[model samples]
Target: MRYNKLDLNLLVALDALLTECNISRAGERVHLSQPAMSNALSRLRNYFGDDLLVPVGRHMERTPRAEVLREAVRDVLVRIETSVATQPEFDSRDTDRTFKLFVSDYSMEVLIPHVLAIADAMGSRAKLHLRPQSSNPARDLERGEADLLLIPGEWCSAEHPSRVLFDDELVCVVWSGSRHAQQGISIDSYATAGHVAMQPIEINEPAFEQWIQAGVGAPRDVRAAATSFAVLPFLVVGSELIATMHARLARLVEPALPIKRMAVPFPLPPIHQAMQWHKYRNLDPGLVWLRDLMIAAAQRM
Candidate 1:
């Protein structure tokens, strides 16, 4: 259990140190006393003949050599943890890992409640962290910073493997007593009516509707724009303004607001919510279980 006359135990300490970059934090992670962790670091430095961690203004930063070894060390530890340290079957109730997901607020509302409730009921110590999605989801997945991306079909890329979670259509919502509701929407009426819309989100391409409309110049009028779908209900309630959004999200907030969901006056393409993950983690058992659980949650919804 030795490498280059260095004890194998040093690798565990090294992994923790490289991951955390702080002696105290690394010690806490691996259950070592601070002094013991320091000794482990000294031994590693002696073996590698380099300062693996350099002190920097009350913080520790990994040296270039340590940075070079970080992924290899972490991967080795993960392999051992996955193949040897734990039971053959992933014991969700006993796992203490955290999963990072890239998702927007609407997807979070739909998935987290169902998924976490099930995990909590099973006595799981695992935690799910959602990062508000940005335009660079594909890159985030490739870099392993995100475990999964829950995104609309238009924004998703086929560069990564994906599973369709659910399909949804856009619906125009108006206040229950609005003119659009009472008089019914015609093409001309729909074109002239004041509308609230979600601002464009795509970075590389135009939104689905934008692409479809091409040169039509966006229907007739946009009275207001909101950054998130969650604001649609509040923005439309008791107002004559109409807002178009995903039907499922419209349903989620419909009961809370005096609003009615009606088909969009024009035929629009359907959008799907899908789960996408890195090719590197596609077969990871814990992630596979999580993906399956998410699919199940979507089905139930």
Candidate 2:
């Protein structure tokens, strides 16, 4: 497509250039060679009569004109994307589109079963690409790399529209033969107890008190630390270390781990698991159908 003798595709290059400010990085984002991106930038500069990107020290910086165009360009592109998407005929039962989901470990264990069950009932060949959520999930959605993000509501970005799927609570997980199992976990016991710390990297929202940003009452003595929740079983059992995890996760994995679940003596805030999507995708029928399906699964969970 051409607009005023301009290859409209260069608008994509312009968006990337203004966003990244580095020619090489912009080229990588748009799948263009550095030289090709440079050429496109030259054309854009000639057309707009502005040095859109300027070399500052060793880094590239957007010019004042580029800064002014940043949000304008983004808005224009989002409008274009929404317009194009609204023209598609998307029927969930007949569509074979693949959706990429950034799902947290807890959600994957407790809620993914319901999502898959509903998908099967829909008689659709739609495939789900499940990936571990990154620290910056909102950016992932904005870049169109992920179709949906399943995370706690607090972590959801205002940039995208989101809805709560379900609420979960923290619970104490102990070996079936542990003292806490026979008795109960009290505030004093919890504070003095040697606890298993499941330290998560690049996580903004944690389902339990093990991680920072969610702890309320008191801190526990960190006896052992594990990277993922999957390793909690090994670290919790056969040791004096007690573990804390989501109530739903503990109940689901109870029979297999020889673990007993108990309510925390001190109340923890309820975590609202939410499903969020890009605002640009609001008018996309395919995405709307999937969002509705996800909401339904959340309700069932």
Candidate 3:
């Protein structure tokens, strides 16, 4: 369709182009051929009377105009998708909507299975795509790149609406044959033990336990670090390393792995796992149904 002598289809091309900043990658995103994408870019440049993307050394960089249009274009597309493209009513059994969610490895192991089971029991045909939690999940929610986010309560975006799904406490995990298991963990031992810590790949900050330990002025001898919480138990197995992780995750992995879980020797606050959504999607029927399903699953957990 044409609006004010401009082809509206070019907007989709422009969004992908500006976001990716690579012609080939942008073409792949929109499933267009390289030649087609190049043509779209040329037409866009002619329409806008400026080059949106220019080469910067080995990489492509967005021009000043492109930077200004980036967020505005994303907002326009999100508004159209949510307000104009969505159906007025939602029926779980009949509708086939794909819900994208950003979740931590902890939630993937302890909570997502329950959610899938509940969805199956309800005979819903909705598909779920679980993406690994990124450093900036609030940005993903704002751009409508994800339908929901499952994260710690403190990390949730204040501009959006969120509900506390469940609360979990931290626990200390050690090898079943380790000396700490036989003698039990004390504050001194916990601080002095060789620890296997978690530092997710997407984040640059310290893990939750590390922050608490820092506040208490206790330092740990971190022997190793892993990107996934699920790997912490394996790293602790057959070794003297101690891992402080979520209680629910520890319990889930304890049956199969030769690991023992004990209470943290120091005082630690509970982790409130929350579900967040874009504020603009507050009344989206599909999102409402999905949120209800998530809440029901969390209650079961």
Candidate 1 structure quality by residue, lDDT tens digits, 131-239: 8887788866654568888987766777778888888787889999898888887666776678887673664332555733442346547788776777877788887
TM-score of decoy 3: 0.93
lDDT of each: 0.78, 0.81, 0.89
Error of 3 at 248 (Å): 0.8
- Any idea what lDDT model 1 has? 0.78
Q: For residues 83-180, could you state the per-residue lDDT of candidate 2 as single tens digits?
A: 87554778767766888999977788888889899989988777899999898888778766688999889888987899888887777888888888
Residue 32 lDDT in model 1?
99
TM-score of 2: 0.82
Model 1 weakest lDDT span, ten residues long:
211-220
Query: Which portions of model 1 miss their true places by more than 4 Å?
Result: 1-89, 200-206, 211-220
Q: Kindly report which residue pairs in candidate 2 clash with one another.
A: none
Error of 2 at 224 (Å): 3.3
Itemize residue pairs with steric clashes in candidate 1: none
Worst window of 10 by summed lDDT in candidate 2:
207-216
lDDT (0-100) at residue 260 of candidate 3?
A: 96
Comparing 2 with 3 on TM-score, the higher-scoring candidate is: 3
